[model samples]
Target chain A: MAHSGINLIFEGQNLPRLLGGLWITIRVALIAIIAGGVLGIFLGVLRTFKNRFLRFILRLYLEFFRIVPTVVLLFLFYYILPKSMNLNLPAAEVATLVFTLWMAAEASDIVRGALISVPQHQVDSGLAIGLNRSQLYYYVLIPQSLKLMLPAMMNLISRIIKTTSLLLLISVLDVINVGQQIIEANQKQYPQGAFWVYGVIFVLYFLICYPFSLLAKKLQKD
Target chain B: MSWQIIQQSLPMFQKGFILTLQMSALGILGAIILGLMCSLCQYFKIPVLKQIVGAYIELSRNTPLLIQLFFIYYGLPGIGLKLSAYTCGIIGLIFLGGSYMAEGFSGGFDGIPNSQIESGKAIGLSQGQLTRYVVFPQGFALSIPALAANIIFLIKETSIFTVIAIPELTNTALDLIGLYYHTNEYLLVLVVGYAIILIPLSIILTWLERRIRYGTFGD
Candidate 1:
């Protein structure tokens, strides 16, 4: 029996459920970007600190997060940490925590790269103007670096939105998980719902990512 | 910090590590071949083939690997074409990695100045001979850094296989964590497992990049 019924897949109540899931997806991504951005910038600066020990520690932090897959990190946070620490939290919270850690590490690298790309002469000239170290960084370094970093940061945000799909595996009802639910519920009548469901997911993700890619291109042009 | 758990988990983790390595090896090979073919298509200006390759690159690059994996694993089965999770994962990796690698290879192609190609032709070299003797070697050399980075990316991306129940490193770590419930130790194990594999990989890549830049084999 070919279950090519679109009505069965897009049943009465599933639309709302999917919309809810989409909302959660956006919420998680936004929160992660903000929290991760602040922490990433801080760590990025810490990475360039003159103190060798601090830089070493920051490097270790960066390497650990960069190498480990986010799924493993999510598993660690959601399953392992609770047992080890004897603390229980909601799945959404765990997803947020884990993704924040992941994003912070990624964003920190972007920030570091952006900061380093600024011309050294600009910093030197700021210093020559009797600007203190803090003043030079805040007044000169940051302004120029932000322009370079914005596009990269936008790219990172798009990445985060797409990666939020992984949160589905951890029991967070994101859009992909919602699609899974619709597929399961209507499997008999809409056996081919997996195609439509995943196709919709691809469209949703493209919608989220394509704009940022365009923005990155525009920023590069400017 | 506990040796007891490490001892218990060693066999499983080791097995998973080997599986991860194999998957990445296959994925990297598939990606290199596909990427090279696609790059060549664009370079040679094959009209329709180039446009199709460009479309494939954009579609693959712009989407998440997890969705692509699910599409292959779950969606294909719906159409009565079932593949094992490992196969699906490998296909997904190839599709994703190929696009990124094409970008890198194209970058390599663009880096060669027009004069180089023209000069080779002026020397009475046939196109094939010129590409083989001149363009190919230099383009490959210039692309070493990008190729190395893509290799690392492919390694990390293999983690997505866990969702489809592939017995790779992350899946093994999850299984171990589920078995022991010793969160800290298991998390530590997970961290160590990835670090041991990736750190050396990163070092080797960095060294390869440096070697390519300086045209010497010293670290």
Candidate 2:
């Protein structure tokens, strides 16, 4: 009846439990991407403002967050911020916030790349047709760049899902954390459950991400 | 933020900085060799090996470096294969960085037109000579910017080693908080520490990108 005696995943209900953990991972990753995408679009558009001071301010903001390590950012939000402000925030909130900040920086890069790449000749042609700045961007520029932007964002979707694995570090009960807990609980019976558990975790993640990665490649070719 | 705080921790910061440098240097060295081998495997249509290399690239590229780190650092030990935390961290980073580098080389290979390869063959060069004289030089030029960018990313990634408590820059900052009891100050110091190292490298990357774009390194 057994598939194999050395089957890596647990024999019974643990497979279902592990799937539940993966579901949490998928949920958190989706929320972070959506939130980050929205914020990133705004920041990206804001970065295009003509005023030097505003651009300087945004550049500093985006650059600072971009350079800082994500784990350090995680600690700042999950540990130090709560302790410093004496206001308790849940680990999920911290993970989401850190990821959102990270995604915003990345997304803004995508947006800026898209916007900048709209050829000046195209803009000049739009101007010749009496289109205003908004119309020029709305009708012509964004459409051209949107093709480029979408594929990059698709790449980020997988990136977001992969990154959610880091939630384990902050003690958020994501798939990796759940897998770790399962291993810890059953260490006596299966000391090497880690090999199996983490292997399965890798497969779960690979299944989710590889498709998006392939799609991004396909879109880039298009 | 404090001068005294910064002054007293300079030595400790240097040690951490050196470790970060060592890690990146080793990682880039390993990645170059691994990336070249993988790219050559792809270029030559090495059958099953090519498929394996492609899968490795996808798996390494798509997964989070931290998850890969956990697998190498923790999961391997469970199977009776153990590496020190530093070694595990570096190996994980090399795989991640190498895959990106390999992909870049593949893209670079794509850029070298089929006509060029045909021309090489038309010249009656041997297969080894064709690959040596034809593929690698142009691909290397095309891949330099990507290599530089991958190196920068790998440098930033060394920060992840902090989670495994390897005393890299970010970890050193964490350790500094223990000594100074000034969390925000060390955070600021860590930013400065990283900036001092990364900003120059990025400038070089930009310059290399321009060089490649402007045909300085071209056929």
* Candidate number achieving the greatest lDDT relative to the actual structure: 1
Candidate 1: which docking quality band? medium
Question: In model 2, what lDDT does residue A97 have?
Answer: 78
Query: By TM-score, who's the top model here?
Result: 1
| Candidate 1 deviant stretches above 4 angstroms | A1-3, B118-126, B214-219
TM-scores of the candidates are: 0.92, 0.90
The local distance difference test score of model 1 is: 0.84
User: Per-residue alpha-carbon lDDT of model 1 for A1-222, expressed as tens digits?
Assistant: 544645554679877887788889888888988999999988887776689998888887887777877777787778765676877988988888887888898888988898888998998899888999788878987788999899878878877887888888788888889889899988777788887788778877887788887797699669
The recovered share of true contacts, given per candidate in order, is 0.68, 0.56
When summed lDDT is taken over every stretch of 10 residues in candidate 2 chain B, the lowest stretch is: B210-219
What do the candidate models score in CA lDDT, each in turn? 0.84, 0.82
DockQ each candidate and list the results.
0.64, 0.59
Q: What does TM-score give for chain A of every model?
A: 0.93, 0.90
- What are the per-residue Cα lDDT tens digits for candidate 2 across A170-221? 7888888878888888777777777778878887888899999999989998
Give the C-alpha lDDT of model 2. 0.82
